[model samples]
Target: MQEVSATASLWKVALSLLVIIAFIPASLWLLKRFQLAQMKLGKTDIKILSVQSLGTKEKLMLVEVENEKVLLGVTSHTITHLKSFPKRGRPFDSELVQAQHEQVRQSQGDDK
Candidate 1:
């Protein structure tokens, strides 16, 4: 009887550990599926346009707030405004494409 009780208790402990291990992955999957990791605070005017990583702990972010676009330098402890651009009539994508074309033309001219 004593041996049987000990075996049952061991089985119960093993089952509990297995359940806890399974729960971690299950909860992670649910959070990723619903994108619950990022908190949403209703609707806001500020939008992140792009992010470029500078180092392990630093990044540059382009953000649009209200009518103006801002370039920000982000570090582990601080966020600094690097520059700001005036609101333009056209979309950012068009401006980016134009800049890319200009760069290509400059490179071609240099090679020639």
Candidate 2:
């Protein structure tokens, strides 16, 4: 009858609202907890100079990210401390690399 249909619709509406309300608190709690964890774990501040993938089983990362240059730590996954950097120069420190690059260029020039 009409009464039955109206009751069913009302119940449906109530349940939907209740479920939504329940999720809001849970989502808020999860968000707050994640933010707190990140803040606690974050080691950002600078002191890292560079990094090298020394082969995967463990990565070697240079710290200070600048002129300081200190090699520190090894990891299979990610230390979060070491982070990652491409071939940015400073850390792969060596005139040898530059010399090797020049040698290659000279060879190519000779070939041309």
Candidate 3:
């Protein structure tokens, strides 16, 4: 009787852990799907195009609002608009991004 109860308790623990592990990713996928649908419906005017973390709790975010682009400073407690500018030609330029990546790689190579 004692051996049977111990085996049953171990199985219960394993099942509980498996359920928790599965639940986390399932919930995340559902949330992402809902958010994407909302974006497709055009419910919001603002979008975050990119983010660079400045520190553990601070970041610089490039956001798009209507036809304008804005750079923002974000921290754990506050958000500040750093700059705003008119939209140039495209929302995102692939060539510009590629050039920036190349420059970063070259700089890292120089450091090493």
Candidate 4:
């Protein structure tokens, strides 16, 4: 009787340990699956189109919410809206493009 009780107690401990070991991986898998589901279902609003780094802890983000595109400044502690771009079908920076082309032409002329 004494030997049987000890064997039963040992089996209980082994089963408990096995359950705990199995639960860790199972819970991690469930958490990852839940996050993925949230991402897939939460895609309707607010999509980030681009991000540019300004400094170590600051960034500029161009995001589209609904139909409007807005530029935002992001930092460690705050997010600020810098500007809202015009509606679709208009150029963003025609002069900037022209200036860049002129610079390239000047550089090529200098090289020649």
lDDT for each candidate structure: 0.92, 0.73, 0.93, 0.93
Error of 1 at 101 (Å): 11
Once fitted onto the true fold, the runs of candidate 4 whose alpha carbons sit more than 4 angstroms away are 1-8, 48-62, 67-79, 83-106
- Which number leads on TM-score? 1
Please provide, for model 1 over 17-62, each residue's C-alpha lDDT reduced to its tens digit, 9 standing for 90 to 100: 9999999999999988676445453467898999999999999999
- Model 1, position 5, has a per-residue lDDT of 100
Residue-wise lDDT of candidate 4 within 1-112, one digit each (tens)? 9999999999999999999999999999999999989988986778889999999999999999876899999999999999997667646598679889999999999999
**Which pairs in model 3 have colliding backbones?**
none
Which residue ranges in model 1 land beyond 4 Å of their true spot?
1-7, 27-38, 92-112
TM-scores of the models, in the order given: 0.56, 0.37, 0.54, 0.46
Question: How do the candidates rank by TM-score, highest first?
Answer: 1, 3, 4, 2
Model 2 residue runs over 4 Å out of place are 44-112
lDDT of 3 by residue, 12-60 (tens): 9999999999999999999999999978898788888999999999999
Output candidate 4 Cα RMSD: 6.0
Error of 2 at 4 (Å): 1.3
Task: Supply the TM-score for candidate 2.
Answer: 0.37
Checking candidate 2 for backbone clashes, the offending pairs are 47-64, 48-63, 48-64, 48-65, 49-63, 49-64, 49-65, 49-66
Model 2 lDDT per residue over 1-112, tens place: 9999999999999999999999999999999999989876996655544567767576666776443445566776556543344435644447678889999999999999
